[model samples]
Target: MSRKLLKLKGAFDLRPWYQRNDYLGWIMRAKRDATKVRRLQQMLDELRAGDAYMNMAWRPRR
Candidate 1:
């Protein structure tokens, strides 16, 4: 009887230098946009809720 040997394949280093740079740039831009979007959404929600304290403080008395 002969036994067959099995070999395991190793994982590939997926990104080269150029691709890594491109991905890093994309990630940074995405983070910045996400922060801005979150801030804007919070402001919109506050406005919709009619947060009286915020409105009274920001608005000038006539």
Candidate 2:
């Protein structure tokens, strides 16, 4: 009976494994999107500065 109790205790004492790769994957995707947004903003700023009418050109003409 004591052996069975020891086995149970050993099972209960086991710690949960940490998921470092899952967290690292999320961080990498976030960094990628942030870089993409910065590049897009820079392009928009350049377009606006180069020509004021360029903003209107982006609108759909009907």
- Every model's TM-score: 0.34, 0.32
Query: Model 1 clash pairs?
Result: none
The clash numbers for all candidates, in the given order, read: 0, 0
Give each model's whole-structure lDDT. Answer: 0.36, 0.40
Q: What TM-score does structure 1 among the candidates reach? A: 0.34
Tens digits of per-residue lDDT for model 1 on 1-62?
Answer: 22211110010123234533543454455557786566444433433343322123332134
lDDT of 1: 0.36
Worst 10 residues of 1 by lDDT: 4-13
How well does model 2 score by local distance difference test? 0.40
lDDT by residue (tens digit), candidate 2, 1-62: 68755664443233122322432343455557886566445434533343222133332223
Best by TM-score: 1
Residue 32 shift from truth in candidate 1, angstroms: 0.5
